[model samples]
Target: MIEIFTVDAFATNPFKGNPACVCLSFMNDEHSDDFDQLFQKIAKEMNLSETAFITKSSTSTSTYFLQWFTPKNEVPLCGHATLSTAHILFDQHLSQSNELIFETKHVGQLKVRKLKENFLELDFPQGQPQPILLSETIVEELKQKLCIKSDIKGN
Candidate 1:
């Protein structure tokens, strides 16, 4: 049996913040043959930004295979989902630890810390956008679209 919960982190009111579907572990459980299909089905059923499934690990305390699926696609790293997941685990699973570690795709070893005012803070990598120059044709198209003849920054 997969226990599911809808967590509202970063906001107390429903639909104000990002909603995530969180699935907890149960004994003698194994995902179906098409796990991705199942994930997508759950995500669509929940109609949220992301859905997370946690399978209990048999050998390790700090280890579990974590997967995240968005409504449109599967994302490697999602800051909001990570925060929601950690908040769920801390408040529901782990009572003694205020911080939770998550092993993710791009942002490996992700940490979510509990903050005052019932907010959770997530630490992840910073993505920097490099400046790029658009071609003359693209510039002309943008100028025609927005009716502005100015330099447009592209990344």
Candidate 2:
């Protein structure tokens, strides 16, 4: 049976910060279409912003294969969810090493290290932001809604 956990990341207390559902799967076999469907189903049921699926790497003791899914679709990367996954692993003593590596399909390897004072550090590649053009009317609307008195800029 797969183990599941709901963890709150970036929170000092329960019910605060972002909550993510983490599913721990023991199956080391290659994922099939059915597996993808099942993960999506579970994410939908959880109804969270993102759900993380983690499996032990077949080659490394400290490495795991990780995937993130929203209620509707799969995403390439999610920081809060990744942190939640690492928190679960470290909290449950699932990893023998203090440093753990997570391999993602799109983002390559993400390294997470446990720190003092029950903190965890994650190192991942930075995302490149794409510029989007916005009309002046839309920008004005946004400024008004956000109660900004100064000019707003949007590419």
Candidate 3:
């Protein structure tokens, strides 16, 4: 039987944060396409926002490949999912290293460090947000959609 773990990522309490199911081992009879279908089916069955599949890394012996999927489609990156995967690895003695590297298809390699017994740090790519001007009509529409009646405060 395949082992599946449900982890609550970014939560101090259980079931408080984004929870994802992690699958460590999976075998496909036919090929890669079959694996994709199976993975999607498992995610759909789990019915979580994200499910992480961990596979052996084709390149590095120490690192592992991680793929995240939702009930609908595959996600390129997920911070909380990655952290949850790392937490499982360390807590369960899946890896010996204090820092574990996970390879991804779109986001490249991610680094996760076991800071302490219950603490972990993830090294993610830096993202910069750009501000855009919004028309009054669009702003008003957004406000109506969001049901914000109080005065808007600018940060």
lDDT of each candidate versus the true structure: 0.67, 0.84, 0.80
The digit string of per-residue lDDT tens for model 1 on 29-74 reads: 4333356677767777777878886554443454444568877777
Measured against the true structure, the TM-scores of the candidates, in listed sequence, are 0.69, 0.83, 0.77
Pick by TM-score: 2 or 3, better one = 2
Displacement of residue 8 (Cα, Å) in model 2 is 0.9
Model 1 TM-score is: 0.69
Tell me the lDDT of candidate 1: 0.67
Instruction: Write the residue-wise lDDT of candidate 2 on 1-155 in tens digits.
Output: 66778888899888999999998764355534457788998899989999999766775866888999999999999999998988887777654568888988899999999886568899978889998899888888999999998977766
Question: How large is the C-alpha RMSD of every model relative to the true structure?
Answer: 4.6, 2.8, 5.0
Angstrom error at residue 152, model 2: 7.0
Off by over 4 Å in 3: 27-34, 127-135, 138-155
Off by over 4 Å in 2: 27-34, 141-155
